[model samples]
Target: MINETELIEQLKRGDDTAFRTIVEQWQDMVYNTILGIVQNETEAEDLAQDVFIKVFEKIGTFKGDSKFSTWLYRIATTTALDHLRSRKRKKRSGFLQSLSGSGGEEKEQIPDFHHPGVSLDNKERAAVLFKAIDELPDNQKAAYTLHKLEGLSYRDVSEVLNTSVSAVESLMSRANQNLRKQLEEYYNKHYR
Candidate 1:
């Protein structure tokens, strides 16, 4: 296998085949990153494509300071985040979701349709839970999603969030406390 530096060199030289190679190499990781953010496979696919288009357009500026994969993941994360923010703006502006979500912080009973997980049932509660989560402050939701849902380590989460690791920890702590209170209220209302 050629080293990543060689791949970057080939890509910099403007070889279309090298670009295809980069796509084939990174698509799964790219797709997974977007899925973790949007929780929608269809949207994830489009976002991943957008990331690649960005990578192609900006490859010449890739400074070579970071590993290519790391650089790519950063691009993926930013693209996914931009897409998420756009969706949030749309949602709040009265766009009805075609597919439903539980909207709470508690893991939904059924496995994520796009991810493998322990099987469970009765996702309506999760939808209600998500509604509560959606009501949270933006920082809290972002901390919870990056730490809990994405399972990124504190350092990684900090890097993605552009905060110190201790700050990430504090944010996650507050997020958990807020989610617990919200979920408890949710449980009493529906499960009591």
Candidate 2:
């Protein structure tokens, strides 16, 4: 198999095979990262696919300033956030059509993720955690997901999120505090 630099060079020259190579190499990371954002099997799949599509479409614009994975993830995060915003806009529009006392209810159901490790039952809990993540501000959500979920170093996360290392740390700290508060509420409601 060709190495990343050769693959990228081919991709820059508009080679479809090279694009596929990049996708095959990094699709798992893209999927997992998108899953962390969208949290639905189908939506995550579509978003992951969409990231590759965008990469292929825009490969010429890539100037090789960073690792390919980092660039791909930046695209994935922006796409997922765009998806979230569109969904929210749709919900808002639907709410406007609802009768009085019906405007406050949301149709989206955030699942529960009580387990962080590998447990079959933890899928539901993981879903819950993802929902809480979606609720966070973009910076906090990006920092938390990049560092905690994606297992990137703080420096890597800062690069991905386009912030300083210190800013990333603070974002993560606030994210953790916010997550703790949200998870505690969930626990109290369900297990207490």
> Over 4 Å off in model 1, which ranges?
95-151
Cα miss at 156, model 1 (Å)?
2.5
> What is the lDDT of every predicted structure here?
0.72, 0.80
**Which residue pairs show backbone clashes in model 2?**
111-128, 112-124, 112-125, 113-125, 113-126, 114-125
List, in order, the clash count of every candidate structure: 7, 6
Error of 2 at 85 (Å): 0.7
Using alpha carbons, what is the TM-score of model 1?
0.70
lDDT of 2 by residue, 116-167 (tens): 3447776776766776787798778877877776899999888787778999
What TM-score does prediction 2 earn?
A: 0.87
lDDT of model 1 at position 159: 68
CA deviation > 4 Å runs, candidate 2 = 100-117
